[model samples]
Target chain A: MTTQTANIATTRTGFGAYVLALTVGVALLTVSGMAQATVLHDAAHDQRHAMAFPCH
Target chain B: MSKNLLSSAVFAGLIAGSVAALLQFLFVIPLLLEGELYETGARLHFLSDGMTQSEKGTPGLGGEWDRHIMTVVFNVISYTGYALVLVAAMGFAKAQRGLELSANSGLIWGLCGFIAVQLAPAVGLPPELPGTPAAELAPRQVWWLSTIIATAVGLSLIAFARTGLWQIAGGILILLPHLIGAPHLDTYFGVAPPELSAEFVTQSLGMAAIGWSVMGYFAGYFLSRSED
Candidate 1:
């Protein structure tokens, strides 16, 4: 591959990974936010509080 | 992501998460347990034997080994998740802007992360103790999300934007969330005393700031070292 081709490939891969990371981060946070008052919610309870996400 | 970058992030996450966990165990957990005492009516602030008092209840952490383990697991996962986002952003910035990511810059990055994720939203929504009453969840969540995104973008512009106009725009974005205001109940109803709640909020934010600083340091250190 030419150097330009390699650069394009690298950029594409990086963009893909960045999107994946962002999606995962958003999903994790949403799950935590929408979690009902259950053990799973409790597991993340302190963190939610510490992060100041407005849990009652 | 490159293997080295991924590995560095994992290593940083593990170490940073562990440090945060240990600090939480030492400093924050006790306050939580104490707050729970108020939540469960296990402890009262001002009442004598002759005076009327609510019946005591089991402490929150009592016979809850599974819950404790879950907290540890959750914390590690949370930090790792945060590290993933931070490292990814770091990579994108470097690739797009030719910005440098070194251990020194990591500290600032981590602080920015803490500000974007914790402090900015917190300005509107301070940490709450267990059993504290709050507004409906959905709206609060929306406001919180917007606050984080706005603050992150705003801070980035303030730091990275070359021109004064862009910097002013960033400042506006930072304040926009607060300008809209966080959802809150008309009435304040807190089972825990104001003092305990105040202490909990202070300690919680303090501990988190430390954790983010350490995580940023390690992430930058490892990423730069890996490059070398």
Candidate 2:
């Protein structure tokens, strides 16, 4: 019973970690996509236009 | 443990992104290029003096290759990011509320995502053309972010809340941001013709709606398959 509980706990921890990573990854991608920094803006320029986000 | 979820989101993002890019290439880009011509003074909407003006030549494929490639790559990446967020939200809903995340249901979820992320906020701030002038960016960004969060939370409550009171609260949340209003300029200052701007806004939103629907369906489909 103790072993089974430990296995379940480990699975939950692993799942939590995966979720955290995904959240961070997506957040970073979104920020960079919207960032005003020259390189990032240029990289995402076409997308910014395509999405109709305000770009001068 | 939830590796399948991540993989499924990636797959859905790729498919949805490709679809969106193709649609934009076919429909949106031409309008955008035409708008740029007006912005650059190459294309005049109406003559200031009573003189017949020659039509401007169409922009050729000169240095747009690099930009075009970047657009495809960025579209895929951004859509994939959006899919990740949607899938993560779905996972949370399933874990917490015992909600089923199947393809058909994903369609609804995707539409909700579109409303929260695109449609609702767009009510105040319609899509702008390349040369369109606007208010300060910082305030606009703040309003946009707040509106998206409020709408998302409001929508989830409406969908998942069991009580009528909670549903009413959700409705309030959805409307609160709009009530506050999005930042806007006192005067309209745009170089592009009003008709062109209006058309751009409509086309942009229409494309977005389609993209969101496709992404939602595929994300849900992949997640359901992964479950099995």
Candidate 3:
């Protein structure tokens, strides 16, 4: 393949890698968020609002 | 693209996501909570009768780790959303052009995500800790500055290092959520406190952007080094 064509091929391959990585990253983020929801809710929840920074 | 290249990119994404999540969890949250911004903002909200704290508007310290976990959880949710968007974008683009997503690209992408998603919604939502009277607009401002600075530094490292394409993808993965936007209180209130509400959206979006950039840089480094 010509030099430019080779470069294009390289880029395509790299782009594919990026897409796949993005998929996995999303999955991890989702799971992590779910794992910490309870803690976030407890610390910042409505009932505790008064103790923290009551808005109303 | 070859299987090796694809594998590296995927690996980079995972690394970037994780790093971004950790930074927010371990560093950003604590800084915001401890800084004067929190107190000043909270005080403003308290004055406005905007918050309803159990302790008569006292901003309690819920252990340092409490904030840490909150940051972590938030980052995770935000990053996950970004990843989904990336997948869709890639599918639509249909033409893979690069082996690795550059660090600078990741940061630029992050800014795009923040503006499109978080900054827009913040136009109506408050930034105070929910149920608190504290205005928290100061901290929100700080958040914006911090996000920009952090993303710029992290993405630059990735771009210059030439580590791998995966890191770039990871950055993009973290960024997508900010671009897509997140849920806020604006949907409920008609005449919400302007400053507070606006700050809230911007801050949330900014945090996500920072996390994504960090993830992208770290992931790129890790995956690029791995022989697998």
Candidate 4:
């Protein structure tokens, strides 16, 4: 019982987990936002297809 | 030189981000799909269909799955930003004394942080997308209430589950900007549909809260175990 409790308790110790998680979080925001923004801008580039002109 | 503080923050951030993302996928996404909030809420329908319509580009569930994956990816990324801030806090808090790293306290602080940063912004801020005329002006109250509760609860889990002084500090720091409020630029183009805005804001806060909570929980978990 004591060993189990100790193991469980140990899980919450130290600062390594926190910093690692922080880095992952920051990376996700920076990288993914850029990726999505790039995709959006490319779609809006207006060169994908020629606009059909209206004939009066 | 114990790397306890720095290491803990990183681990906690990932755990929190994952947990928050899962919660979002499970409860929040379903709510968003089924809720009347989007139907009645302000929404933005972009003229150019962006990544949201990728399914049309590729055949079958690939597009559907891709979008889901994107949601998880984006959610995690946002949390990552929050985590960086928490890391700085841990380093600072480690230098100080008298700060208790109790799980319960962390949760309370996490919840308060969510309210300060996310909810407070809604008071004067207009919805981002377009929606039905009625909802455009007065959205369903569920928009605010549901989001607030979801976010508070999600973040509290992380805070309450963790253990450490620095962990506690990191948790609070993660939430600081939202609590004090982020800088905003007025006169932005496009707004969310009424139904979706409520859902999106709630989801945004929920994701953020959980991300911070993860930082707290893991920080506490690792710090308690590390040899001091």
Q: Using DockQ, give the best candidate's number.
A: 1
Q: What is the C-alpha lDDT of each candidate?
A: 0.76, 0.77, 0.42, 0.43
lDDT of 2 by residue, B1-228 (tens): 267567777888888888888887776776677778888887877567945344533354347788777777877887788888888788777767778879999999889988998898789878776777788988887888789889999999998899999999999999999999999999976766677777777887788788889999998999777665
Q: Clash pairs of candidate 1?
A: none
Ordered list by lDDT, greatest first: 2, 1, 4, 3
Model 3 residue runs over 4 Å out of place are A1-56, B1-67, B73-101, B124-128, B132-203, B213-228
- Show where candidate 1 strays beyond 4 Å: A1-13, A31-34, B45-63
Candidate with better TM-score, 2 vs 4: 2
Q: Can you write out model 3's per-residue Cα lDDT over B55-121, one digit (the tens) per residue? A: 2222334666655455444444445455344433332233433344444444555455444333433
Best candidate, lDDT: 2
lDDT of 1 by residue, B1-228 (tens): 465456666777778778887777766776777778877867775465645344433244566777666667666767777777888788778778877889899999999999998888878888887778889878888898899899999998998898999999999999999999999999987777677778878888888898889888888888777654
Docking class of 1: acceptable
Chain A, candidate 3, TM-score of 0.36
Candidate 2 is scored at a TM of 0.88
For candidate 1, lDDT tens digit of each residue in A1-56?
A: 68767556444435777777666655655555446768667778876665566554
Q: Cα-based RMSD of the predictions, in order?
A: 4.0, 3.6, 11.8, 13.0
lDDT of 3 at B211: 53
Once fitted onto the true fold, the runs of candidate 4 whose alpha carbons sit more than 4 angstroms away are: A1-28, A32-56, B30-63, B122-196, B203-211
lDDT tens per residue, model 4, A1-56? 98778656543434654455455644644454333356632331111000000000
